[model samples]
Structure formats: structure tokens, C-alpha cells
Target chain A: MDNHLFLPILMPLIGAALAVVAGQRRMLARTIVLLATLANLGYGTWLLWLVDAEGRQATQSGDWAAPFGITLVADGLSALMLIVAALLMLTTLIYSFATLDGDQERFFYYPLLLALLAGVSGAFITGDLFNLYVWFEVMLVASFGLLTLGGSRGQLEGGLKYVVLNLIGSTSFLIGAGLIYGVAGTLNMAHLGERLTTIQEPSLVTAIAGLFLFAFGAKAAIFPLFFWLPTSYHTPPVAVTAIFSGLMTKVGVYSLYRVFGLIFPNELARFAPLILTLAGLTMVIGVIGAVAQTDIRRILSFHIVSQIGYAIMGLGLASVAGLAAGILFIAHVMIVKTALFFIGGAAERIYGTAELKKMGGLAKREPLLATFWLIGILSLAGIPPLSGFFGKLALLQAGVAQQAWLITGVAAGVSILTLFSMLKIWNEVFWKKAYTDVSQLPRVPAGLMIPGAVLALASVALGLGAAPLADYSALAAGQAFDVSGYVVDVCGVAGCDAAATTVRQENTQ
Target chain B: MTLILSLVVGTLFAGAVYLMLRRSVVKLILGLILLSHGVNLLIFLMGDGLRRGEPAFVDSVTGAVSANAADPLIQALILTAIVISFGLITFIMSLAYRANQAVQSDDLDDMTLTDKL
Candidate 1:
């Protein structure tokens, strides 16, 4: 059963290679990508079920044992992340099938999408920090291809900022990995966790954690490092933007939760206050930034930054409940944000412009589209009976439990602004009368709206059925914080001692 | 020798940061290449400096390599880093060239087409 764990990482990789080989045959490429995504989704659900029943599993590649060879691990957290990723990949690929132009289809779009999947899935499964860095590069390279496609002046303009910032982010990430290896003498995460607990200096490990935070900070689009996100994210194709907003930044947040909770549990208190401060700032600034944007995609981009604050707030709360809430919030936001982007894309198809100033009458023209969009909007603004409300309530409750008054205030305030801005989009883009001649507007493609409409419906379903997801997240969080169990399971009994000796031997040599 | 090597790595990192901060897109790409070099070197040094030790394969009877020989895993990681960074650098160069072709400028400040409207 442990051996079956590599199948999730392998399937997308095989699928990607085939997709690239079938590049000229557009139908073959799309079909392969669709099948691969469906298979991955199935595999992810199975893996989650297995983990739920059996707990965490680990497998070292090449038949070598742990701490010696590369290991892949899957606990509830990884399984949950994988399923979320596969689900997004499937929905977005379906959306792209109908929406992407012939020009894009002829390009390497399908292959790049699969490659990004491989990278993302690989990052979640790898038990080694250095391997995680490698997977990050894989994702980055694929994104470069996806982002810069079309070569429009705006795309090139946005793509450059995205490229440069992310490259720096990768470099910082590499440096951090190096520092950790130098300190710990092993890059295997379980080994690192074991060694970290025994090490005398909390500050040293915390310092490395800070480096990771900065590196991932740029990726997650946290404040002071978030300029790259709003500047470039609006420039991508709506399908691309949907996937980007949905999965990419959350990967960074996930890593933060993993590394701090797994390898640096002793240092959480030192990091929590700072994380909380950043959380509050990230929320206020992100929402305010959204208010300033006139473009549909741009507003959503800023809100991505703000919603990230709630997830980070969960990290700050630093309790099992808090982390669970963070996990739930991240999952909730991923679907809502992607659905909103899809709706924007669908609306853009009809209105022929992304500028909210120029577009209106969508609600009058397409009430289904408007109503579908309202589920996402209402859910995002923390309304009751919606997914976002439970996410916020959990965070607010977690904050109260932790005595984090400032963040609780920020969360409350941000919800109001969030509703205000979302309503702004509702008024300007959907409900308001058309700005120009109404008959000149293009027809809303029913096919394109279907993907987002389904997702919007799913968001409501998720909201109504939020309890199971919250329970699942709490279970995942339990797995994350139980580092001793992880070290024992991944490395085997007393493998922690064996890993430490190995590190010592490496240093002396 | 270790001191000089580390100094070289530090110089590469410092210079890379300087180049990355420049307004020119090409300069930014060059900075990244240098930064990767610094990182790869840091990782290489992680395996430890030259020490008096024989290859573990000398003891072929037991099939267990001696601990004294440099562990090959860190080097393998470094090689992987080099290849990945090389690909990233090439991609960024092409992306910069494409940006230049599209916008007719290498200056990042001038590459703000989407932000102005």
C-alpha cells in the first residue's frame, strides 16, 4: 500500500510527457489531459480514504530505506491538498477545453498544465526539503510558459514581473534549503524534524524558518511582497488566472503550515505574533487594494491576497483548531476564488472587456450567471449558510481562543469591506444598466459559464455541508502537529536516532 | 581554499543581488543566473570541504561504502539544482527577449502596460 503512494506523482508525469508528444494533435492532447486529471482525482480520493482509515504512509524510492534515499510521504494533509489540487485541475481543464482559442490550443498549453500538476503534486508528496525546492522550480518553469503565452504587450509586461519576482523567490528558497541542510546535515523533512527537536538553539531554527517565510511570502503574495501578484495575475487568460488564484498561492501557505508545524514546532510562539500581525495587515491592505481596482480580474487578484490573510491567521492561532480552520479556509477560498474568476471570464466573453467601468447588464442579460456569481460573492463575504462564513467563524473563534484580539478585529472589519467590494462588482458588472449599445454586446457563451456555474453550486453545497470538511481539516491538522508520530512512521522505530547519527557522520567527514 | 571558495560564493550572491535590482530586464536575468551559482556552490560546500578519506567502494567485500568518502547525495542534489536553474535562466532570457520584442524596451519601469490603464 505504501508503494502505491508514488502513483499520484507518476500519473501526471506520464500524462504530461504524452501530452507533449501529442502536441500537434489537439484532440489527443486535450483527451489525454482530461483523462489524466480524472485519474488523478480518483487516485487522490482513494489516497484520502486510505489515509483516513490507515493514517500516514511513507515510501523510499529505489528500494532504499528512509534517511538514506528519497522518500515520499502522505498524511491526511498531503492527501487533502492533492485532492483539492486534482479537483481544481479537472474543473479548470474542463473550462479551458471550451474557452481557450485555437491559437492557445496549438501552443503547449495542455502539456504545461499537466507539468504544473506534476510539480504541485510532487511538492506535496516529497519528504525532502530539497526535493520540494525542485518541484517548486518545475511549477515555476511551467507557469512561465503558461503566463507568457500569447505574447501580447500586456502579457509580456505582466509576465516579466511575474518571472523576475518568482525567480528571486526561488533563489531565496534554494538558499534557505542550503542553510537548513548545512545546519541539519540532512534534507529529509522527518529527519529535520527529529534533529530540530533535539537541537539546543531555537533561534537558529527560527531564523531558517524566517528565511522560508520570506521565500514563501513572495509566492503566497503576503504584504510588502505582494506587488507581483496584482500587477501580473490580471494579465493572464481567465482560465489561467482561475487556476493560479485557486491553487498556487495556497501551496505557499500550505508549506508554511507544514514546515513550521512539522520541523519548527518549538518556534511557533516566536513566529505566531509576527504571523498574526502580517495576517491583519495582509487582510486590510488586500481588501483596500481590491477597492482601488477597476478591472474585474484585478479586484479578484487583490482579494486573493486578503483571503490569504485569514489562512495565515489560522497559522498564527497555532492550535490544532486554528490550523484546522486555516486548512478549511484555504480550501473554501480556493473554490470561491476560482469560481469568481471563471464567472469573470464568462462575463468577459460577453462584455468583451475586463474593465468593470465599461461592462454592465450581465444580471439583466444572464440571471443564471448573475445568480451563480452571487453564491461565490456571498460565500466570500462570510455570510451565513455559505462556506466563507464558517471559515471566518472558525478563524474568529480560534482567535478568541488564542486571545488574539487584534486579528479578530481585523477579520471582522475585513468581512465588511469584503462584502462591500464584492457588492461593488455586483452593482457595476452585473446589476447596473449597460454602458453602451446593448445589442452590440456579444452573446454570453452558455458552455463557458457551465464550469463556473457548477463550481458556484459546489460552493453552496460545500457551505451547507461544511461540517465534514471542517472535521477532515481538523484531522489533517492533527496529523501535521503530531511530529513524533510522523518521525516514527516515516523513519521507522528509533529512526530519529539513526537519522541524527547519519547527519553527524556527514558533518565529520 | 575553503575560505576563498566561500568568498567567491558570497561575491556571486552579492553581485547577483545588485544585478537583479537593476531596471534592465536582461540584467535581472543575469542576476538570477549568478544567484543560482551562489546557491549551487553553497549546497556543494554542504557535503563538506576536501578531507582525507578513501572512496567507500574500496571495501567492495561488504558492499558498504565507508563513511569517510564524500556522500554523493548532496552532489546529486547540486547537479539537479544546476540543471533546473539553467532551464529557468534560459526561459527567463527568452521571456525577456519576448518582452523586449513586444514592448520595445528592456527597462522594467517602461514595462507597465497593464498598470497604467
Candidate 2:
């Protein structure tokens, strides 16, 4: 069962190679990619069940023991992320079938998409910090290709900012990994979990922690470091943008959860105020940016930043409930945001533009799409009996429990702004008089509408069935808080405590 | 040896930041290259400073690695980082070149088609 840990990462890589071999055979490539995603969905479900039934599961590569070889470990958190990612990948691929141009389809689109999935899965499962850096680069490289597939003027411009900023972020991550290895003399996360506690240099560890926070925070698009997200995310093809919106930033958030929650609990507590303040600013600024945007994708792009603040808020709270709320928020946002982009993308396709001024009265022409869009935004705005509402309620409840009144107030205010922004999109794009004759406009194909509907319904289902997910997130958060079980799972039953004692003795000597 | 390497790393980083702040897209790619080099050197320096020793190999006699050999792990890490950065730098170069051609200027300000409010 532990051996199956690598299956999720491996399948996409094999699929990518097969896709490359399929070459100009577009249908074959698409089928290959679809099969890989489905296989991963199966594997992810199984892994989640295994982790839930058992404790954390770990497999070290090539028979090497833990702390020496690369370790792939999936606790509840990793398994949940893997499953959500696979679901999004399948939905995005289906959406792409109708929206992606033949030019892109023929030009290694499926291959690159598979490669991106491989990277994302690897990042989720890897138990080594350096390996996480490698996975990030793999994802970034594939994304660079996808973002600029058509070589359009807007794409190149957007891709440049995306590439440069992310490269810097990756470099920052590399430095952080290198320095942590120097400080703790181990790169494996499980070992670091033990070793970091014994390390004597508190200030140095804190500084390194700051480096990591900046690196992952930049990638996650927190507050001031988020300019690249809105500028570049809106420029990609809607399918490309949709997948990125769903997976990429969440990976950064996941890293924060893994690193701070597991490895540097003390640092996380120390920096809680800073993290909370950043979260507040990110929410306020992001929603304001969204409210100011006229382009459909651009508006959605800014909302991504705003939504990320809520996830980080969960992290900043630093309790089991806080972490669970963060996890739930992440899961909720991943589905709802992607669904919005898919619906927004379809609207963009109908009028052949994303500018809100040019599109109106879509509700009358595409009532079903309008309905799906409403479900998406209402969920996004955290209205009652929706997944977003449960996610936000959990976060707000956690914040109040923690007595983080300022950030809690900020979060409440931001949701109203988020709703206002959604309504602005609604009024301009759906409810208003037609800017042009919509009778002549092409109807949205089933291919596009179905994916959005599926994900929107997923949000509804998640909301309706919130109990199980809430419990699951609590389990994941508990695992994250208690790193001892994780260490034992990865580093044999004897554990690293003996090794840690020896290191401490040597330092004293 | 550690001090000199640290100084070089600092200089490289400073240069990279300076170049990255320039308006030209070409300079941005150059900056990324310099920045990667700086990070590689920093990694190398962070590991046990300059050491003249045998390659990391286990002594069959003792069944343990020779204590004096430079850490092979750090070198392996550097190699991996270098290869990844090399590929990324090449990709960025091409991206910038194409972006330059598309926008008809190397200036970053001119490439605002996507972000214009």
C-alpha cells in the first residue's frame, strides 16, 4: 500500500511521455491524458482511505532508509490535496476539449498539462524539502509553456511577468532549503521535524523561517507579493488559467501548512500576528482590485488573491480548528474559483471578449450558464448552505475562538466586498440590457457548461455534506500539529529521538 | 575561503537585483541568470566551506564514509539546482526574446496589454 504512494506522481509522468509520443495524434493524446487523470483520481481516493484507516503512509525511494533517500509520504492532508487536484485536472481537460484551439491541441498541450499534474502531485507527496523545490520548478516550467502556447501578444507580456516573478520565488525557495539544511543538517521534512526542535540557534532558525515564509508567501500571492498573479493569470487561455487558479497557489499554501504547522510550530506561533495582518491586507486589497476590474477574467484573478487571504488566515490562527478551517477554505476555494473561471471563460467565448462593458444580458440567452454562474459566485461570496459559507463560517468561528477580532472583522467585511464584486459582475454580464444583440451570438457548448456545472454542484454537495469533510480536515490538522507520528511513520519505529539526543550531546561536547 | 565565497555570492546577488530592476526585458533574463548563479554559490558556501579532500566514498575497511571528504550530497544538490536553473534560464531567454518581438520594445512598461486597467 505504501508503494502506491508514488503512483499518483508516476502515472502523470508516464502519461506525459505517452502524450509526447502520440504527438500530432490529438485525440490519442487527449485520451491518454484523460486516462491518467482518472487513474490518479482512483489512486488518490484509495490513498485517502488508506491514510484515514491507517495513520500516515510513507515510502522511501530505492530502498534507502528515511532521512537518507527521498521520502514520499501521504497523510490525510496530502491525500486530500491529491484528490482535489485530480478532480480539477479532469474537469479542466474536459473544458479544454471545446475551448482549446486545434493549434494548441496539436502543439503538446496534453503533454504539458500532464507534466504540470506530475509536478503538482510530487509537490503534494514529497517528504523532502529540496524535492519540493524540484517539483515547483517542474510545475513552473510546464506552466510557462502552457501560458504562452499561442504566442499571443498578451500572453507573452503576461508570461514574462509570470516567469520572472516565479523564478525569483523558486530561487528564494532554493536558498531557504539550502540554509535549512545547513542549520539542521537534514533536508527530509520528517527528520527536520525532530532535528529542528533540538537545534540551539533560535534566532537563526527564526530567520530561516522568515526566508521560507517569504518564498512560499510570494508563491501563494500573499498581500504585497501578489501583483504577478492578477497581471498574469488573466492573460492565459481560460482553460490554462482555470487549472492554475485551482492548483498552483494552493500548493504554496500547502507548503506553508506543512512547513510551519509541522516543522516550525514555534515560529508559526511567534509570527501569528504578522501572518494575520498580512492576511487582512491581502483580503482588503485583493477585493478592492477585483471591484475595480472591468475584464471578467481579471476580476476573477483579483478574487483569487482575496480568497487566498482567507486560507492564510486559517494558518495564522494556529490552532487545530484554525488549521482545519484553513484546509477547508483551501478545498472550497479550489473548486469554486475554478468553476467561476470556467463559467467566466465560457462567457468570454460567447462574446469573443472578456471586457464586461461589451457583454450583457447573458442570463436570458444562456440561462443555464447564468444559473451555474450564480451558484458559483454565491458560493464564492459565502452565502448560506453553500460550501463557501461553511468554509468561511469555520474560518470566522475559529478566528473568534482564537480572539483574533481584528482579522475576524476584516474577514467579515471582505466577504461583503466579495459579494459586491460578484454582483457587479452579475449586473454587468448577466442582468443588464444587452450591449449587443445576443440572439446572433453563439451558444455555450455543453463541453464548457458541463464542467462548470459539475464543479458548482460539487460545491453544493460539499456544503450539504460538510460534516464528513469537516471531520476529515480536523483529522488532517491534528496530524499536522502532531509531528511525532509522522516522524515514526517515516523514520522507523525506533524513531529519530536517539539520533537527536546524540546530536545534542555532540553540540554540548 | 568562506569569506571570499560569501563576498562573491553577495556581489552576484547585488548585481542580479540591480539588473532585474532595469526596464529592459533582456536585462531581466540576465538578472535571473545572475541570481541563479548567486543562489548556487550560496548553497555551495553554506555547505562545509572550501575543502580539499577525496571524493565521498565509504572505506570498505571501516564501513563508513571518510570524514575528510567534501560532502557529496551538497555537490549533488548543486548539480541538480544548476541543471534546473540552466533549463529555466534558456526558457526565460526565449520567452523574453519573443516578448520583445511581439511588443516591439524591450521596455517592460510597453508590455502592458494584459494589465492595463
Using Cα atoms, each model's DockQ against the true complex is 0.53, 0.59
For candidate 1, give the docking quality class from DockQ.
medium
Residue-level error in angstroms, candidate 2, position A358: 1.7
* Residue-level error in angstroms, candidate 1, position A108: 1.4
What pairs collide in candidate 1?
A: none
> Interface RMSD in Å per candidate, to 1 decimal?
4.4, 4.9
State candidate 2's TM-score. 0.97
Model 1 over residues B29-82: C-alpha lDDT tens digits?
Answer: 888888899988888776654444564354545445565787576678889988
How much lDDT does candidate 2 score? 0.91
lDDT score, candidate 1, position B50: 49
**What's the lDDT of the predicted structure labeled candidate 1?**
0.86
- The numbered model that scores best in lDDT is 2
Give a tens-digit lDDT track for model 1, residues A1-509. 27887888788889989998998898899889999999989999999998899899888888666786788999888998898899888889988988889998888898889889989999888888988988898888888889888888888888888988888888888888887887787888898888888886667778888889899888999887888999888887888999999888988998888888898887887888998889889999999998888888999999999999999999989899999999888888988899999998888878778888898887877888899899999999999898898999999998998888888998999999999999998999898888787677767676688878878887788889998888888999999998889888888778766854665555455
